[model samples]
Target: MTLLGDAAHPMVPRFGQGAGQAIEDGFALAVLLEHAKRDKIPARLKAYQELRLERTSRV
Candidate 1:
């Protein structure tokens, strides 16, 4: 399953990009998920983590 919107990234909620970025992440995750089934959960999650980490680290 993929999490999206504010449900995924609960940021300051003032940047206005939280929802937008979450949607972007959802789409990206969907593309990643389509490439692999549940077997790719680890990798998919890793990708999400990488993205979130990168974004958060930038903050």
Candidate 2:
């Protein structure tokens, strides 16, 4: 459940959205780090994975 960006989606790096997902991951990680929270790690990661799974899979 440790999702990290569009590693699943893997866009063409066009429109600069490819790395956007990674940036979002970074932000999310930052928030969790700052709060020392781990409760939602698995769920959040799973959600991120699901979000990018189809989109990146097609790309």
| Cα RMSD, each candidate | 2.4, 4.0
Model 2, position 25: C-alpha lDDT score: 64
State the displacement of the C-alpha of residue 24, model 1, in Å, after optimal TM-score superposition: 1.5
Give the clash count for each candidate: 0, 1
Model 1 CA deviation exceeding 4 Å by range: 1-4
lDDT of 1: 0.70
TM-score of every model versus the real structure = 0.61, 0.46
Give the Cα lDDT of each candidate. 0.70, 0.62
Model 2 misses residue 25 by how many Å?
Answer: 1.1
What tens digits encode model 2's per-residue C-alpha lDDT throughout 1-59? 46566664466758887687678666655655564457866666665556656655554
What tens-digit string does per-residue lDDT give for candidate 1 at 12-59? 758687766776777777776776877878888788767766664454
lDDT of 2: 0.62
